[model samples]
Target: MNEEFVLETKGKNRLIISPNQYCFIKLPSSGIKIVQLRPDGVISLGKFGCFEVNSVLNHPYGETFEIIENKQARAIYTDAFEAGNDDEDLEEENISEAEISSKLLSTDKENKSRLDNRDVNDIGSGVQKLTSVEIELLKKDSELSNKGKGIIEKLIESHTNFNKKTVHSQEKYVKRKQQKFLKVFTIEYLSASNLLRFYTSKDFGKIHELSEESLGLMISLADVRPGGRYLVVDECLGLIVYTMMERMNLQGEIVLIHENEHANLISLKYSDYSEEEIKKFVKTINWLQFFEPDNEKIKFPIKSETEISLLTAQKRSNYYRHKRNAEITNSVIDNVKRGQFDGLIMASTLYLPKLLPKIVDKIGGSRAIVCYSNNKELLNETNHVLLNDVRVINSKILETRVRPYQSIPGKLHPLMTIRSGGGYLLWGLRVIPGDKIKATGRGNKKS
Candidate 1:
């Protein structure tokens, strides 16, 4: 009750409230929720079964909350409330008045609000009051749509903690919950306008990494032109491909590449493009693997001849070496060739390091783009290395942060929410012979 609990994210369907202070408990997204840090082992409310908060706190996040459901427990008001409600005996057993006061702080505060105090009078009829200026700010956020801004404005109008500070706090809280729950499905072939709508809507389940916002940013940064021969590697469920197709309107085909084991290719299904159209543009390069010979030519090599020569030179009698060498050589040859790419765009963690050099080489004097996570140390190092190379020009790191507005009774505040493992973009155009520059330094005498 008096203790502080930091929320921890588990990989799956679990959120741990406090690790150091109390028992671990399984938390359903919605249920009769109960938390009692005091270690008497049970917190009880009528209809809802008891919960031991300390019992589950010790376990890691993402661990399932396992509670035995009581079948014979008679319903008080509804079965839904029964799931989260605690035993009625705890109210009976409590002795000290002060002990109960702290435990009820959050609940008591909630009860004072009109959302809790008033009975429902048609959900839609509730009036919203917010200033025009505040509404405009939310509208400009890129993360919010017209409807979303309207909702925030309504909260502000209602005067529910509507100040700037409280609004941001509420936004963060809501944003975190949205990310966790909304990112559960894949959206395919979404148009730029529609994609924006979907992101602001927050009804898509869990937003994918290649969600519309990411794609829109990609489109803007890439500066896609019709005639460019682009090399692409996207681990984000072909969301990149959809962007290229919609925006680039290419004269030349796009070469979409990936690591051999990448499962994203299996998920690529577009309503607009036929299988043949997809095949015509995409060339799959299976790393260190061979396929039965086919009549159709693959622009991307299954293995390069230079790689074969390297393997022969090494004289190591190992299958792995031969295969690995071939993949490397093919990628290298592809990257340095001018015709291989007009520009490069990649969104792969494993392929970024090895693939980027080859892409820069192949792009010759074209553009190269690489997306990475902010936590990645290698991206910074890679940018420094590329900048030092004379053939690389205009290297930059770009990041875009999103904050959405939720329509609720309280003021909108940003929750501590940002999609984990996203937010760094390394980009630049390539340089060839004519693009070279010389630098002058002051003459120095030998010391």
Candidate 2:
């Protein structure tokens, strides 16, 4: 494979892990943690267990590794495996009452009678005989053998009404217990979708509640791809730019317009792309420099090396700063003046009407203009403005959402709670305007 392909696949398909690359260290019951793997390292998963970084360094992404305290016991779980269930292959007759009743107590007559009379839907915590402290003790003692399998088995044995539960409910109880006690975690590559999920879960404010589906639509509508020159205004701290870069496969140039003096692409640091790769694809310019290039300042001549060697340290520093700024400013201005971009993508909190007009004209004819806003009312107002402007055509606002469902067989249903509000996208196609044409007053003449 080529260098780019190999880099992209390092944590994707192949089982090789590289140093200094970010990987998701998922935990049982707990959520995911994005960690940068270093050579000769150790990662602690808290209550689950701690592991040597080298143990998983060379493993493939998406494989689950179980942690064990004993070196010899760890031998069986060393193979990175995918966790799954054989429930689909199980027949109803295959389930035995003895296996289900292993956790129930027949000696307690009153409790047994109460469980016998209780409805299936009336399940409660009182059915489990093990207390919270007992479960914790069990967890402490079960770290060696099958990781936490012993703990789960003991908990099942202590559940008084486990046998009374329906097959589906029984499976669910086992699954929940397994998730809590299992000392296994899966490693995954840091893709754009994964990054969005990570930030959304960790800090929704960072990404402005932007979901993977909404981001996918934005990229689709904007026609983001390799070798495409696009104009972007990212208020989400380079999330849009990062998505575009991934879509472009680290190719093409993006002219990023920012309201601040420097672009705040803070989240880009978490991405797998190197500094050189990001620099190759993204170029930043403030609104002031982009809208009005200071021609006089940029026209200043650069001092030769010999002449600069004669200057003071502070003067030399200032001189170099001016030279670099002038070059960058001139480049941005030259590109803007040369021609329009392939598309325009904006994700800002600014008023769309005011912002759209300023940059919409810069978009090349037959290109797309996509704007993202969390507020529906803002996009609604922007749509009205686009309808009146002749330079834009087919203006519309779209909202996309993803509702997740439980994939379990025979018990499949929509999840009780799911992430909502992926925001809205305002889409319009940039076009060249024709000459003005007026109609004569034919009706008045006939009258």
Candidate 3:
């Protein structure tokens, strides 16, 4: 009776954007917004304007649409952002090759004459007509009145030195302004990676500023496969688990150990996965249960015969329910204690030095152990500990960064700002040593 309809991307309508499922809309400003569209619903894009959900139903994602009069929308080519695009976009989303590279080389022409920025300081050296306080007021007014385009135009007109800037500089300034003022958006399919991007744009700290590369790398290092058991300790708001679920593809079992009484799976709350599938695919246990599964459960299970003889018919049925639950709980505890898990993948703030030893044995031999943290020192200490323990070999810390650049021919160069703080990972392999590792400290000392 409690069924949650998860939007499936596998059916004939996989390409079609349907109603009543969580969708991530990509604003022209590069901001992402999530919504569950209803049949006759109207969603507002704030200063970008509002439109009816049904107006864009059945359309494939990644196509840009302009909001016309009377809340209407039609196909439009967005050339404003064609100059600089990253390969990550081509890999993350499902955009065709021609679409992204259509006009990529248009900006490759020889350098143009530009203005000399003799005075571009923080203190208004006459670059801007509005003061800091005045600009704040202007923003508030524009946001409240839903008039961003006018405000942007007014600001550009107010700039005393706009004409003096170089052609390249002027284009950069306008592109930045249009990014904030343009009232346009593209509908994006909610893939796991896209969902991570949505949260990253909204708040980088929420997901530890996780990069697509790092997340994908962790899955690879762990070597996650169908039917393999995984032990996960995710403190990144269940993002790690959600991404893993996509890789598991509803085949393997993910035993999630939550730090709280209830699993902090807010990211998965809006997922299209059914409650039944989630229940079957993901098994949960508290830290106490995972660290110590034998105390209350190591003893004999609830005596069904004793409870049945003392209780009424209704009470006996209740007893059976309790008995079944007890059995399931013990089963999970037994499996974890038996060391059958395929891998140990963790992304928590807990001290790795003290935590690694406790959970390392859970993973099967010749398996992988991948630990992630935003701070490098955490992994540094983890790496040191893993190398000392002969069971874990090839321990090292690795960081991933996705750099973007201007793709025009002859002008290929790195962008001013690149992705920062995707996080560091401590990767190693688990081994079962047949003999204790011993070394002789000769006059040369141990190598």
Please write out the lDDT profile of model 1 over residues 1-447, one tens digit for every residue. Answer: 101111121221123333223222222222222133454355443222344545544444333322233211111211111111222223434222211322232243344333331343322323334455654455344222221324333443464332322323333323332222211111112343443333334433222344445556665666656455566766655656656665644234566665655436533352244465555445554433212123222334344666656765445356456556556445433533424465667666653455466446556355656454333465676776666566666777776656754323344355446444334677776766342232321111110
Residue-level error in angstroms, candidate 1, position 407: 5.5
- What shift in Å separates residue 141 of candidate 3 from its native position after superposition? 17
- Candidate 3, residues 162-183, lDDT tens digits: the string is 6556555655665566666655
| Cα-based RMSD of candidate 2 | 6.4
Give the Å shift of residue 9 in candidate 2: 13
- lDDT string, candidate 2, 1-447, tens digits: 113212232122224556677877666564778888776678777776777777776666766666766421121222112132333343445332222222222232224334333455566778778889998988878767545667767876787666666545565566677677777777777777877778888887767778889899999999887778888998886888878877776556788888887898987887777686676567778777777765423786878989999999999999999888778677777777655788999888889887787788788999999998888899989888777677787888999988866765555677898876688999999977654421332222211
Instruction: Name the regions of candidate 3 deviating beyond 4 angstroms.
Output: 1-14, 83-162, 298-324, 407-411, 435-447
Give the 10-residue window scoring lowest on summed lDDT in candidate 1. Answer: 1-10
Task: State the TM-score for model 1.
Answer: 0.42
Clashes of each: 39, 1, 3
Whole-model lDDT for model 1 versus the true structure? 0.42
Worst 10 residues of 2 by lDDT: 72-81
